[model samples]
Target chain A: MAYSNAYAPSAPELPESFVEQQLDGENRYHYAYQYQPTQQFSSSSVMFPPETHPDIVKSFESADRDRSGFLDESELRQALSFSGYEGISDRTIRFLMFIYKNPGDSLRLGPKEYVELWNCLAQWRSIFDRYDRDRSGKMNSTALRDAFFHLDYMLPTSVLQLMISQFDDGTGKNVELCFDSFLECGMIVKGLTEKFKEKDPGYTSYATLSYDVFMSMIIPFIVSYD
Target chain B: MAYSNAYAPSAPELPESFVEQQLDGENRYHYAYQYQPTQQFSSSSVMFPPETHPDIVKSFESADRDRSGFLDESELRQALSFSGYEGISDRTIRFLMFIYKNPGDSLRLGPKEYVELWNCLAQWRSIFDRYDRDRSGKMNSTALRDAFFHLDYMLPTSVLQLMISQFDDGTGKNVELCFDSFLECGMIVKGLTEKFKEKDPGYTSYATLSYDVFMSMIIPFIVSYD
Candidate 1:
């Protein structure tokens, strides 16, 4: 009675599911800042109750409850299980915590933060594409360092410092991440900063270097002052 | 020092990475699996490790960390991240979690599960060679149900109970899972019970329905339970 209306197609249903040979089977999919389609798929298609795919659109749609485009987390949490990840699992959501809970504040992913996230994600695909050097279609360690190095990231100073220190462990053959490691390190730092700092203080160019490098590079002037 | 010993080549080694199909451009393979050949590949016809694609071998070798042959959670966690999952982010990892965790237990996918996954994958070759009944290269609900009803699944009571209950919801009037879901669900269940159920549930012909009937009549049962 309930989902019947929610899931059943209001539009003219096709004789079967879309015949895109390229679609992963059953309209199944996941959410990610990814550059490729997955391998999992099936031949089965549907002709009715056509709520299908990427699941993100579905989640957003469900959350918009009244058919409005905008969303709040409460509404999102209720209707969208998203196979188990709800809003808490969304990248835009995490980004909000970073934005609103400015180190001094404890705000959640507010509307303001949400807008910034949308802006970033809209362009993140192209950003990720540019750094994928091997052209394998993904941004791994090298790709990550390149993005951070060439582009402007709005990260905090402390996080930036950690980036430089953690990656440059003495031996400097592979100074910057290739892509894979970049994502790993970036995410780890993001997680820690969120839990401890409570907000993003912001990032610096020197954030790419460590304390020792900072001492040799920036301290010459600052320490002299101290 | 550790990696040095492994590099001694007994034969020619493939290039550190895959030879790009230059004319084609690797749009599809940007995030496909990477293989790196650590040891000098003795001349082989398969991967051309000693001469090329050694990196592909290397990637697989890295993923199979323990040399366990089949990838486990840790292995999959690490391996897939290289492809773009960013270490199974909550967004991307949701679908996998659903399949592996199902109703109970953290699943350890093995060769059987792997093969089924492959079977369900979309191919450019033939959609209807045999799998599709309507020449659509895709399966309609009836065809899907018929196959399911007939499988020799020694289903757990909970799973069976779920299926029967779903029958009551009536999604099965004339519907079936696309090829991929069908394989994933059936194969995982079969693999679990037959290969890893621990208790070794025996197959019972009596309880098993025909694939035709399952697609036709029992799919609603599955929907309700799910």
Candidate 2:
């Protein structure tokens, strides 16, 4: 029930008219943030809006059950996962910590440091929870595949399979994902497709970057900062 | 007053500590969506969540002054502009209409189509408003320039000038942007930077892309869809 309420509106309920259009094969509905296979969105230079940090702090501190004044990685990960990043991975979570940490405190996150990371994670959670239909605390592989397609990605099944495997919760079942792992997968696909779109701006809807570019640009961000 | 209240919490309110960090030349905090000039985020294949659409409809219909059963371009533009996209242009509004319109009704947008377009514009507005610190309905050149930089772009002033010009509202004053114009600018900066990162994924805070990508991938998206 907890997850269900969180995901109650996952498929942003469109009016019947639009749904009819979709059923009639008129896939004309396009979301502004809908990932375009061949287009890149401009990045904004402003930092997170100042007012949202408190709610994040609230959430972070609330998740800090022991009141340690800092959230250990696992606690932070658990907090984020339950809050909506159901499929994010340990690796991606670490990278997030790496990118958002305070100067002296590398491993544990203070409230100030945690707020910054929380802002981004919150956005990711909003987006992630939107597509997490079953609310089973994980996006099953089939659902994961659909999520990508909805974002206009056409990844190969093998790649999708491997991605799910990386975040498999060791349940002996290989198809579902938690928030951290899901975020990791989304980031990679968005990152690569964004690149391909840049190179093949002719509306190819697909692009091929050099291996060098792939290695140099796409790989480092995801591989872990440690 | 309503709009102001709505916007009051738009920026994540950081505690004093983070503010101190920002003031003290410690720009250590970073957004997850910060467009890295280099590096790729793996793409997650998921569609936009459906629940968020109704709130969009409520906003859109509330903005419909004449109650024409649809939001004309200007009404739509005004709604979105004041809502958060302070410097959005007529061209981008039209393009939004084009991308979100029903097949037969190209000129006027009903709540259904408007909700989809509103979703993207709402996002643009969220990012745009955060940078409109004064709430002046415009971001001056310095602010606009900083907005791009914050998104990790290092655009040549010439390119920035051209971009500002294209979306200029023709007020004879060229130093600032309304929501329409600002949204147009943000799109280009984010689009190109996203691509560059895919190629130059090193730790460079800035990267460069060809003019061709700008003209193709981004330019088309913001131009009039009509």
Candidate 3:
């Protein structure tokens, strides 16, 4: 089973001191440590690039400094506080609790768990940015409407206002939407507006149209008349 | 079967005589000729109530001049080109011809058609007004982005830009979107970007999540690496 340089590329057991070369472009796994979402100027428009969540990986990687993947309370607390969470915000670590779903007290997530966290957090962040069209650190009625249109195809102006109202939490009775309450909702499509608001003939309903395919013929499927 | 009116409710029929009755409030057949969409706005929101077209049948009554269900070319042209179409120059009309599927056809629309037209044109108007968030009628990049975010997601920014770029046409590119374009294209989605740009990985491609449901989740689908 002896091998030469051509057959093995390098000594099979030379890892003790051999230096590895990094590839050009995205091939570098290091990229997993520096990803960021592209800029978005408006909710009506989307500016996205691929491969987000590098920062999350960097943090998680740091928490798992020993490369053992799983993090104990100390590592978890450090990661949590670094991520902008208070020491004990929800009274329970949902992420850790989630890992315990398989039963037993084995709630620790290792490297694989860390990767999954990055993926989820990364996408959630992106969704938040998408809704915040102005990316001025806030989203407004127009941005949310644009998002709703892309989402369903049914947002009567009133229903839209209601969705905005839910997040308004302002002193003014006439509350329009902005980025103010975004963080409150966790950035995921947790409780998006229903398909339509049921109303009579005079009742208004608008379907939120987001994506498209095939021909450009406008397809206004009343996802729900209600 | 003959039906009798309890209180001689003004018949859905229009009086052929020149009647100056106030038409009373809550008149089913003619509530000041108000359309829900048009009525919801404040004086500041819209440019002006779309001039009731000559053939618009403000009441169940026919047009005093045209006597048609939908206004004829002359009547609609007058309505569309009124002070509403104010600065629109002839050169602007020429450009609109290329952008719209059937631009040169006689300028006329029925009630249903007018609704479709307003839905699209009104959105563009909002963009213009949004740039003037303070309603100052001027804009900067911040204003532009905010206006853009406020724009419908299905609206194509490039197409909008093309329309504005041609503004120097002297005639003013005030070609309001008519019914045909809407039934044919503009109605396809909310904003133009949705028509083009590739899906960002930031999003879950909500197309995948509820591929069978609707597009509303697309915004939350974008993953924020930032």
Candidate 4:
């Protein structure tokens, strides 16, 4: 597949050779390598585009033991595990529900939403694998920056540093982010930016918010997640 | 003043000598050392306990330059600096307004709320100082834990570790928290615990929450502050 640079016009410029290297067949193979599992999953059981996948639908129905047409937290937990994401944290699950649920919906996930969430997770997993350059199941600061750049988020250096320190695994001297932390960090940046954009509709990067407005807008983001 | 152990029944037991050591005149002197400024501020212009302090009231009136009887963000920023807390972050100031303002009040602070806020800052400053064992203006993980213990919050070790890593200054190998980070860390733990307590009124350390309740409660804390 051809890499598209059209969406990332604001992305910081890099050396021409570096751009070419990233687009070369080897790197394309890397993307393909990480995406192979999803392909296999599609070919073996159901079609691609998880929204229509029979396995996902079956998993959700089976996990919804109460047959309420919605999966509660515990049920969602089981459903996600069945979809190969085991031991997902309660905080992450809550975050997922917050982002994907339809308006007027409770915290639970209906089948359609669950399938969409499964697709989202698959995308995040693919991103994680592509950035885990050493195959250590973690991304160092440089890899993290590159991954976000690939995703079209030109985060400031200070913000990137904050994310690194906030999500450091405490293993040792080196800072690294596992898959879950990467997801959380990315979602937080995306969510906060969206909130800020609401106040700065002109994309001016400046917003004047009354304290109450600021608190009301930010408090939910701060309090609800891990 | 005599040290009180009466409020911290759940605090981890220490050697009798260690307890005595902490209560000795030297440690008491350390507390007094940090408290000296507030004492001087009280004696020179107004009394302590802050609420009735003439100086605090005057500061508030001066900060309310518009004579609106409330201090907006910029005015509150100046007022905090006047009270010796220089360069307070906008996030911290908003958090203070969230905690101190009356139910119907807007983001700005009235005279009564300003005075109360000053008192609260003094208390937090004292806590930060007491735990900054080497007078380094920062607290390490151990000091951070001990400070919470002294405050009657027996946070689990895992939670303490999370606080340390989350608030690390990134200066070097050591994880140290400066005063502002300390204040944020303590407030987050206290705020989250209070929210959790509402659902676990029996103090059972367990609560059953629907996904909606969990997200609504936790998101505010996650989103609003730094």
Candidate 5:
């Protein structure tokens, strides 16, 4: 139930200037720093990069119950939950680890990586809020298309229809996606495209895969999201 | 149970010449026409292209229970099972429909498209058999890699590891995949790749997608496979 209510859409709408700043690219980070959350964190001993928000640091320190200065899979899961990312899948966590974890370390996220992850999540959070125009905590197919178009994905209409149908709550005639589902969707696209690029370095839009290798690469993303 | 036994690996290995001919590209179809199944079909009123295999024709006729020339989703599903493709997911069926159904039609497959589908499956079946050298009804990570490599998809070890871990039966130390699972894996890779190519026609390997569009495109493949 906590996870269900994780994105209850209570935050005030972002001002028009904030949207313009986000479009200006470099200024987006400036706005993220300027934007303040209603919730406050208690002061902590942990020293992070000056750019790292205190809220993020508090969330991380609280989740790192062992205080190992590193967050393993379980700790990372807890950290995400504390940050309002509920029901985070192991695959998504691994994907986050794949992106931000230290090169030599495969399973743990150091403080720097944790900070980076928080920033990335914040950026995505802004994108989600921008498109959920009704502040209903969900977006219909058209809005979903506009949101992705704003991101430059240019997906086919059929593909868009398939997505809404999959996540449709069934109570309504229109397909609607909540914040958590939107995050999962974003990560899968980002993750798979990155993986595909490894083989298609030439950008040929064509890559051949053996049955098993293909299965192995994709099954995690597919199964975890389900 | 029949689906489980679908790829029992009882067929004799392809002769060296057949492998060489397959590598020669155009000669592969000639060989397909020449290769004969032991099972025989009785004389039938239905006429087919000279190139079409009688076994394929027989399978199609049997699955077309209503004597309709075209196969709807359920009929197509039954036809695939009759052709040794069992446990086929609805998503995959929709995918097949997407590929083979007529331009004006969204659901049914005419005989021509059905034949093309059969040929495509046959090609995939050979590919599966070729990589399954041990014929234990499964392939380990290395074999999976080689199989994909043969198909020109050079995926990273991390991706392959993730995939195997996903479908791993847990009863064994090593991950192994059966024919049906292999089919599902290949379809996901092929399906997602084709979808990605639509947006990345320039083959830039960098296509932007909105969270929702990305989710819609991928969720189908992911959920159905699971």
Candidate 6:
């Protein structure tokens, strides 16, 4: 395959399995990460859902605190909060802004950009909601583990504890996860997972690579914003 | 668990499964990455194989081309080449040197540091040998992906292609992986896989974490050298 400045190829058409609906939730989760090609960034490729849902528009308006017809980082955070997400750090908000912001415009998200952001957030929220089970506004460690497992990452438990300790808002003994934190974890794991799969043109959901190939080549891009 | 500057608490005692003899090669591969805890970095914590293999000493001496009683980056590359490994880029060699070299002394590897680097490289070599079934000196793409799969990463094929293309000796169509490149890829994937499992306290092969928890706290370290 030709290497281009484009970080990823165009978002692939939804695969047969996705359209066929044969996949269970777990399989669908894996399929989404494993099969959905990493999206390339270009103004033309900024795919908004065919039509913005009314709820999304209303939520976006609510977040437009100044009603400037745009959503800045703060407004994006507010919108996420209004939609029942909390604990989103400024860094993460900025990252989404960087990813979705229109070409040559970094100040704020116009309505089209806002809808794109809103839809993606909603998708992620639904993922979080599925595992929150009790809807307690926070997820315990088990819920968190299952959430990732559903995404097909069967990571070890100690790593999870260390990960949780990094953000567990409760007193020392209690471990809980809120939506924003979950979103952050999902993004990194999912993004890396997709990058790992880029070699599998065969779509066998697997690839073979050596350590040197990853470090000198893949990791820089993983760390790079540009 | 208490958060400490310590990367990993003293390497947990090798698990009983490792001590038991029933594990097949694949199972052993799984055990090393999936069950083996991520190693921490402390000078005192550096664990060498109980005894130095004679081959390591011989190779180190050869790489000490000038017989200065130390191995610099160029020497390290030659030594690795002598051990049926070649095509290691200078940058990768330097990174390993920086990783394993003693803090105050960056010039070269003395005998002690040489043994440590030798042991780690030897372990990585054995891993490559398992996949290079033909002893052809280069691994094809399938071998590369299976190597990671054995280490518990189910990365997709395209990612593997992107990874391989970076180091593929082939002009445009052929994909070949020599040992040095494999070692680098294995190290990063293994390291990241272990980090992913760090959250799993139970050793149940799974953990749950939120994106915010991971991004705000863990990602910087993932991308950072120190």
Candidate 1 stretches greater than 4 Å from native: A1-86, A90-226, B1-129, B149-151, B154-174, B195-226
lDDT of 6 by residue, A98-209 (tens): 4455433434676666666666676778878899999897788899888776655654554565456445332335767677777656665555444444544454433443
For candidate 6, the lDDT comes to 0.52
Write one digit per residue (lDDT tens) for candidate 5, span B1-226: 0011123343222222222231211222233323233443435444455566777887878887887677887899998898888876665675565445543343577666677777767776788888999788777778877776665555456555555554644222576777656655666555555445445545554455433333344555543211
Per residue, candidate 2 scores C-alpha lDDT tens digits across B1-226 of 0011121223222122212222212222231222122322212221222454444555565677776667777887766754555445455665455445443243566654555566556666776687899999778877887776655454555445445433433232555777766665565444334444443456353334432222122222222121
Q: Cα RMSD (Å) per model?
A: 24.3, 26.8, 25.7, 21.9, 13.5, 16.5
* Ordered list by lDDT, greatest first: 5, 4, 6, 2, 3, 1
TM-score of 2: 0.32
User: Model 6, A222: alpha-carbon shift in Å?
Assistant: 7.7
- Which ranges in model 6 have alpha carbons more than 4 Å from their true place? A1-50, A62-69, A103-107, A156-162, A168-174, A202-226, B1-226
DockQ of 4: 0.04
Model 1 shows how many backbone clashes? 70
Q: How would you encode candidate 3's per-residue C-alpha lDDT over B1-226 as one tens digit per residue?
A: 0111123321121111101111111112121332344432222222223444433233212221454434443344444454254333232232121122111122334454443443445555544654555654445334443443443232234333322321212222343322222222222223222322223223322122221122222221121111
Q: How does chain B score by TM in each prediction?
A: 0.31, 0.49, 0.35, 0.72, 0.63, 0.56
DockQ of each: 0.01, 0.01, 0.02, 0.04, 0.12, 0.03
Per-residue error for B153 in candidate 5, Å, reads: 6.9
lDDT per residue for candidate 4 within B1-226, as digits (tens), equals 1112244443223212212221211221122112122332332332233336766766776676787767777898888887788867766776666555442334566655566678768778988887897999878888988998787666655445434543422221477877777777777666555555555555555555432233333433442322
Better of 1 and 6 by lDDT: 6
Clash counts per candidate, in order, are 70, 72, 44, 18, 8, 49
**How big is the positional error of residue A146 in model 6, measured in Å on the Cα after superposition?**
1.6
Cα error, residue A30 of model 5, in Å, equals 32
lDDT for A76 in candidate 6 is 87
- What lDDT is reached at residue A73 by model 6? 75
Which candidate wins on DockQ? 5
lDDT of 2: 0.48
Stretches of candidate 3 off by over 4 Å are A1-56, A64-110, A152-163, A170-226, B1-226
